[model samples]
Target: MPNARSVVVFDAFGTLFDVHSAVARNAASIGPASVHLSEIWRAKQLEYTWTLSLMGRYEPFWRLTERALDQALARSPEVDPVVRDTLLTSYRALDAYPEVPGTLARLKARGARTAILSNGDEAMLADAVASAGIGGAFDAVLSVDRVRVFKTDPRTYALVEQEFGCGREDVLFVSSNRWDVAGAVAFGFEAAWVNRAGVPDEYADLAAAMVVGTLDAIR
Candidate 1:
């Protein structure tokens, strides 16, 4: 069970925010390829992070996001160049999940320290948070940019302890991404896998403390 002193850290993209909404918003311009484009863009974005990490190289997540978009667009040449610009702009202000504000409010009401720990760069996180109008909901919005690396990295997870001065056990790390939950579990933090899509599970050896279909089910 969580307590007032427990820090409830959340993954921003896909967890609290809807990363695919950018493409959804531009569906009229993207035609039948919108879903595929969004899927490829996200997969490549994550791939770049892991690949760059292993190569001991670093780039801002925003750059990787744009590059991923380029690849997605390359496979979708039917989309106008103007639409690509619009999609990129839309991504910076992706919509928050409907339950996010309420869930964060409920957690804060109980005196839990809430925060967003994301692989996004600081500016990207800032734009998304502000656009969602949930800027005041978090005690902090931590970005992997500080360490110049991405998730599944020990240093990336260490930001939580460094910010809250709490032990791993006292933190409940929540992410919609199963791999991220696995990484948190491996780092010794109690984690919740927000399996929002009801997808099949992986990383069976790194089980989450809890698995829920939505953020509201966390408590």
Candidate 2:
């Protein structure tokens, strides 16, 4: 029997998939530049999203990601046209964290419905999920595209309640991103923080229900 709160909603990207996998996978071409590229690329990508959102300028996450990549590798001597294409291609098939499939399966066996509420566009989510071989694991994959907004938007978080027809408290919203955890909690969901990097809780005031290091510790 499932608990009263039987729905688990995950934040995709860095939570389930390693956002740096593409760079690491193409390391031969990218060289030692992968480390700096990953950090700057991720930061710039997120900054672009928020910047666009604040300006009411809407663009697909894919577009923002490509632009961020251009900026990240713009001055790097290591990246060539071919390496750039390879890194972009690798992004389509990101590596899933080792425990993701098992954790999802365990939740499913317990009669819980699992889903992904991601800032990723539908196409990106589909490609990554399919590549990770965890496509069938989710009952639904909710992309911000449907609402046409990024996370931290109340509308994005509302998708979970909308899909499950349950109150916020009945959906255990899990995210590895601190901002995302705070956003879900602020939106009234029973949010949990997957502090996988062992960082201190920056949003401790958000009152998250759980502050564990991984999805497997969601309870």
Candidate 3:
């Protein structure tokens, strides 16, 4: 892993925020199987992100997520419009995982420079950070909108190094997604896979600096 003095950059959605919780909160109105619906909604949302990236047809994350949700809902028309609105409203205030505040505090206390590199828009991310009550925890919050590209793209990862005013080697990047871990490594940042789901076997060749179960485990 990079040295402790190096800046640490994080992926916003899965790394810091409990995006699943937001979905779970709204899933009930969308269908009878609320949890399952939320799972499918998340899967489709990510699928659309990667698909759009590969197709070189980029859209904002909010619009893309809404489109993916609509498609997922079509498979289950029994889903209630009220539930959909509930979930959509919930997006405006996603909860951070329980470990987040303490972990961020630890990093900040150590004088580590921290930033969020997310697929979300600046406005959306700003609100998320503010509502989470951790807006002051980060040195900066970067969005893909600035580069018009998503994670796994070299340009997206470059933002981390740029914002920290450091070389890629001077940053410690953390991500829960395997592809994102690989991309950050490829971009020359020392990367860590916060494999909270225990799915690291697929990324054996990616040479991450560390593999921890959660943000709290990071040193």
Candidate No. with top lDDT = 1
- Candidate 2 error regions (>4 Å): 1-4
- Residue 166 accuracy (lDDT) in model 3: 88
- Across 58-152, the per-residue lDDT of candidate 3 in tens digits comes to 89999977877777677666676456667777887888888988988999888888899999988789888998999999999999988887878
Per-residue lDDT of 113-160 in model 2, one digit per residue for the tens?
Answer: 899999999999999999999999999999998888788989999998
Per-residue lDDT for 216 in model 1? 90
lDDT of 1 by residue, 1-219 (tens): 444337999999999999999999989877888899999999999999999988989899999999999988887787765777898899999999889889988998888998899999999999999999999999999999999889999999999999988898889999999999999999999898999788998999999878898989765
Q: Give the TM-score of candidate 3.
A: 0.92
Pairs of colliding residues, candidate 1: none
Query: Candidate 1: deviation at residue 147, Å?
Result: 0.7
Q: Clash number for model 3? A: 2
Task: Estimate the TM-score of every prediction.
Answer: 0.97, 0.94, 0.92
Error of 3 at 25 (Å): 2.3
Q: Lowest-lDDT window of 10 residues in candidate 3?
A: 23-32
Local distance difference test, per candidate? Answer: 0.91, 0.86, 0.81
